[model samples]
Structures are given as C-alpha cells and as structure tokens.
Target: MRPFLFLGVRPEDAPADDEYDAMLRCTGLDESTLRRVRLEAAPLGVVDLDAWSGIVVGGGPFCVSDPEDDKSAVQRRVEADLSRLLDAVVPADKPFFGACYGIGTLGRHQGGVVDRAHPEPVGAVTVELTAAGRADPVLGVAPPRFGAFVGHKESLSVLPAHAVLLASSPTAPVQAFRVGRHVYATQFHPELDADGLATRVEAYRFDGYFDPTEAADVVAAARTSGVRTVPPVLRAFVERHLHPRTDSGSGRGVLRDEIGAAQG
Candidate 1:
C-alpha cells in the first residue's frame, strides 16, 4: 500500500501542524500511513502519481481571487506547482480531496469562476446536501443538513460544467463539488473540531479571517456547533481507495461501490 500525501500550504508552524494532525485523525491514518509536505517552504517538482494512493490539499492564507499585484512571488510559485500537479491528478482521475484553498486551486484549473463575490465570516454555517449528493455513497449517510466551519475571502461563483454539485450553503453556494468521480473539493473545513476551530480562530484572528475582538465569540460558537457528519468523508477516502492502482480499470468496479457503502 502506498501512503496518502498531504500537501499543506500554511507557513505558520501551529496551523500547519494542526491541519496535518486533524487530517490524519479524520482520515483514520497513522503517521506511517500518511506523508505530509509543506508547500510554503518550497515548490514541488514532478510528482510520481503511482508513488501515492491519493492526494489531499489543505486550506491556506492565500486567495486565488486576489489581484496579481497583491500576490507575492511564493504564492505564484505555489499556485504554478499545484496547477502542474493537478494536470497529472485530473487526467488519471486519481482520488484527490481539497479543502478551502484547495477548492480555489481546483476551480481555477478547471475553468470555474472563483472570486470574492461571496465572502463568509468565521463561524459555523448551515449546509445542505443536494439531490446528487444524497445519492452519493459517501454522503448518503450524512444528514440532509449540517453545520460547517467556514471563513473565506473568496468562493466559487459557479461550478465547472464537468463538476457535480454535492453540498451547498446559503453563503457559499458551491460548498462542495466533485470532478471525474474521484476528485473532490470543499469550501468548508471538514477537519475542524471545536478545539481545532478555536485554535485556528486565535491563529488567524489577526490575519483577517475575523476581527480580533470576535475571537472569543467565534471560539464559543465553534465549540457548540454540530459538525459530526463531515469527517466520515475523509475516512471513506482512505478506506475505499488506499490501494495502489496500476491497471487502468483498477478503481472502476465493485471497489468504487464499496467505498460509497463504507461511508454509509
């Protein structure tokens, strides 16, 4: 079995480690089963797709919708590297999961409109799965509606033609989506628990996710918010598709159905 690759974008030590730890917990993967790489420190070269079972990209401070002049050189390099990676991942239809910043990356690459037209505040928000989402194996067991932690400066204005709308919220209409059956992206943080949300609130308070004064309030709300339905999606990814896929038709049959059933 190959290890799952987790690409993190945050430069801050605490947030980076927190994101990685949370992902590992939700995916039900031990340290040996997962490999984490920080994109903030450097750029990634050619990634051998077969070397890993799947890819997971986490949220970051950067925004794709920001003006070119406002983006630093590091941001440009990271975006370019991710584009190159997606070029490989999308063609193979490999299993890929991306959170907040990951959605922007995948959306921009697939020609979807991503902008700051709908910016959500830092707190728990209601999300409802769509008809297709309800039919999806992994999401079938999820409640029709649930709370999710979201705080972003930009969001997907419209989904790409090839993408399937999975979950949606009043503020962020394209909360979650899928492409090519195996690739998924979400605007909300499925890795967040109450304590994790509070940690991030404090870490990013000065970074514009929310006003410094509201940190206490945000933490309070996050602690009480119910978002237990999201993590199963992460565990499903690990259990359903963690095996090495060498043959072209490897992940297309019973295993695919089993993956969905495993989630339910």
Candidate 2:
C-alpha cells in the first residue's frame, strides 16, 4: 500500500506538526502510511501522483484573496508549486481532500472566485449537505447537518462551473464541493477537534482571524460545539482511495504510468 501525501503550508513548526498529528488522528493514518510535506520549508518539486494512494492538503495562515503585491515571496512560491501540481491532479481526477486553505488553493486553480466575501470566524459552524452531497461517496459519510470547525479570511465566493456544490453553511454558501469523481475541497476544518481547535486558536491568536482578545472565547466555543461527524468524511476518503487497483486501463494505473514516465 502506498502512503498518502499531506501537503502543509504552515510556516510555524509547532502548529504545523500539530495539524499533521490531528490529520493522522482524523484519517486513522499513522506516520508510516501518511507522509508530510512542509511546503513553506521548500518548493514542491516533481510529485508522482501514483506514488501515493491520495493527497490531503492542510490549512494555513495564508489567504489567497490577499493582493498579489502583499503576498510574501514564500506564498507566491507555494501557490506556483501547487498550481504546477494541480495541473496533474485535476485533469487526471486523482483522489484529493483539502481543508480550509485547501479550498482556496483548489478553488483558485479551478477558476473559482476566491475572496473575503464569506469569511467565517474561528468556531464551529453548522454545515448542511446539499442533495449532491448526500449522494457523494465520501461526504455522504457525514450527516445531512453537522458542525464543523472553520476559521478563514477568504472563501469560494463563486464556485467553478465544473464543481458540484456539496455541503454548505448559512454563512458560507460554498462550504464544500467536488470537482470530479475524486477531488474534494471544504472551507471547514474536518481534522479539528476541540483540543485541536483550541491549540490553533492559541497559535494564531494574532493572525487576524479574529481579535486577539477573543481567542479564549473562540476556544471555549469550539470546545462546546461538539464537532464529530466531519472527521468521518475524511476517514471515508482515505478508506476509499487507500488502495487503487494497478491493472491496465484503470484510471490509477494509467496515471501511474504517465507520471512515472514523465519523471523518468
């Protein structure tokens, strides 16, 4: 079985590691089966999509809606690297799951309007599944309505024409969507539990998701909200894509051959 790749853009080591651990817990994958790539530390060089069962991108402090001039050099590099990688992931319809910042990266790559028009504060929000979401193989694992943690400065204001709306909240209309058969993105953090959200509230206290003075209140609310169903969606994705048949003519097998040949 191939390992699943997790791309993280958090520059801070403490929060980045914590996020990875949280993902491991949520997805039921250990370090051996789940690999981590800190994109802030280095460029995302040639990635073989076939080498992993699937890909999971973690959220970070970077906002895609920020002006190009205001973006740090690292942010620009990370965006460029992701664009290059998505060039392969999207067209091939590879299995992918993105949370929070992941929505920005994937949405922007798919020509969606990612802006600050629907920013949600650092707390739990009730996410309701759409008709399509209720039928989706991965998202269907979640209830039609459940709470999920969210704290972001930007969202998919306009979903791409090719994307199917999945779960939504009252505030964020495009809370979750599927691009193809396997690609998915969510504006909420499915990997976050009460303790995980509280850890991030402290780590990013001054990052402007909310007023620094309100961090404690945000943490308290997160602890009380009881977000449990969202994590199962992530687990379902891992279970579904963890083993791809490598026989000839299969999608994963063809992708493996193409990527392997390109790399060689």
Candidate 1 Cα RMSD after full superposition onto the native fold (Å): 4.4
Off by over 4 Å in 2: 243-264
Candidate 1 lDDT = 0.82
RMSD of each: 4.4, 8.4
List, residue by residue over 1-264, the lDDT tens digit for candidate 2: 999999999998888988999899888899999999999999999999989889999999998889999999999999999889899999999999989999999999999999989989888898998988877777766666777889988999999999999989999999999998899999999888778787888889998889999888888877767664353677777877875332222122222232222112
- Candidate-wise lDDT, in order: 0.82, 0.84
Predicted model with the maximum lDDT: 2
TM-score of each candidate structure, all chains considered together: 0.89, 0.90
Model 1 ranges off by over 4 Å? 243-264
| lDDT of candidate 1 over 45-151, digit per residue (tens) | 88999998899999989999889999999899899999999999998998899999999999999999999888898888887889877666544435567677888
Please report, as a residue range, the 10-residue window in candidate 2 with the lowest summed lDDT: 247-256
Clashing pairs in 1: none
- The TM-score between candidate 2 and the true structure equals 0.90
